[model samples]
Target chain A: LAKTTQPISMDSYEGQEVNITCSHNNIATNDYITWYQQFPSQGPRFIIQGYKTKVTNEVASLFIPADRKSSTLSLPRVSLSDTAVYYCLVAKGSNYQLIWGAGTKLIIKP
Target chain B: SQTIHQWPATLVQPVGSPLSLECTVEGTSNPNLYWYRQAAGRGLQLLFYSVGIGQISSEVPQNLSASRPQDRQFILSSKKLLLSDSGFYLCAWSSRTEGPYNEQFFGPGTRLTVL
Candidate 1:
């Protein structure tokens, strides 16, 4: 089974750039790296996704290296509202493809 | 314009009670459905998924079972609730059009508290 590893928790001040890295060495070939964010009492929300190189959207940026062993989610100038748990997700099979990271609980202080 | 809905935003039940949670999707056809559980301060745990009606695939072995009576409806049930069953339940769906590795969209989630 594929697995993803990420920092358990992180702390950052308001208006600071935050970068969360995820390690998924067993990720399937051609599988896209996905990120999700969840606030308390809510379900996970899709943040960004990428295959390789770099992809940027209004919410966040995803950077995947050549080997695809890992990926990073870069949030620009985060604020207090950005405090949430971020997860890294990937898949291998059609039936059993729910592999995901443990999540990083980001705390942004104002 | 696709959306997924899960009923009973919050529930509190005693142990040994029967349990049922409903999930439905709209604006999509023949999509993949998934049920997940998340304990406090933990990651999401995949409980069940269905590719179509009556094609449920369970990921973890527990006192829970799932059924897909309709293409867009999924249900999670338990004969007797366990104290350990208390957690936040989430329902999600993905389209095959996104390929074999589709990104899932999650519902608002239901919080269950079994005492």
Candidate 2:
């Protein structure tokens, strides 16, 4: 598992987009970047994943630079319920363990 | 569709007491199961993982142990509970296919409080 770094916290307004960036300078070729969203008293939920370039889902978009040293998770039109901790991870294989960072707590205010 | 289920939404145990938490996956076979603990204000710590029935791997050396008696069934147990063992426990599983890169699906976590 490759180590990842992310902001500790962020704030956003309702109906606004929130972008959380993560840095994994030592990421490996086989490693893929993945993100999870966790709310208080609940399990972490899968957000998006990408190896390179970009990946998008109904909920969020993941953008990876050509260098692949960093990535960003973009959440569109965040609502109050979007307030949660976001985790960034890098894995090489199925058995590849996940190393979680402190996570970025996004508080969506009205 | 596959779903993971965990028991005892919350537990409060006394020091020196034994502990056991169970997790089972439905609608899936030969899946990889994992146990993770999340402490307040911190990231989740991987406790154990199982690849097959009766196969278990411990990421952190501690009093807690994990077992897989059957496919899709994973258990976390401790002979003597420690205060530090208190935290949010999460169960997750991923398909064995896709060669280890499959995204993991998590179950609602169990909150443990040790007295």
Candidate 3:
């Protein structure tokens, strides 16, 4: 199984860009990095997904280095509503199950 | 478009009581189903997943078990609830055919409170 590690929490100001990075040292060749955002008492919402390089969606962007050992989720001009627990995850192997980390609790301040 | 549904939005149960949580996906067939739990201020913990009907995989050993009686429905049940079982329960579905990424769609979630 591919385990991910991320910071427990972070703080950012409104209208500022935020980058939360995750480390998956033992990630397999087929593993894909993904991110999700969760608000209080709700299921996580998909933020972005990527295998290598970068993947950008309307909500956020995912940047993966060439080695694929780590990935960063970048939020541009974040707002207060973007404050949530952001999870970094990877698929294990042969289409492995999504393994989640402790997540980065992003706090967007005014 | 595809959507997933989980019932009884919120539930409260006493310790040692039986528990059942239902999740259904609409407008899709033969999806990869998953059951996840999140404690307060914590990340998601994958409990169970199903690739096909009657095929369930347990991730973490616990009092809870999962069943897939139909292609698009999954059930998470516990013969006897434990206080440790209390948390936010989420049901998700992904498409293997979509791609290698396997992006998942989640339901609204059920808040389980065991007293």
Q: What does candidate 1's lDDT look like per residue over B1-115, in tens digits?
A: 9999999999999999999999999999999999999998789999998888999888999999999999999999999999999999999999966554677889999999999
Q: On residues B1-115, what C-alpha lDDT tens digit does candidate 3 reach at each position?
A: 8989999899999999999999999999889999999887778899998889999889899999999999999999999999999999999999957543687888999999999
True contacts kept of each: 0.55, 0.76, 0.66
Candidate achieving the largest DockQ: 2
DockQ scores of all models, one per candidate: 0.63, 0.70, 0.66
Q: What is candidate 3's CAPRI-style docking category based on DockQ?
A: medium
**Can you tell me which runs of candidate 3 are displaced by over 4 Å?**
B98-100
Candidate order by decreasing DockQ: 2, 3, 1
Model 2 chain A: ten consecutive residues of lowest lDDT? A92-101
Interface RMSD of each: 1.8, 1.6, 2.0
Better of 2 and 3 by DockQ: 2
- Stretches > 4 Å off in candidate 1: A93-96
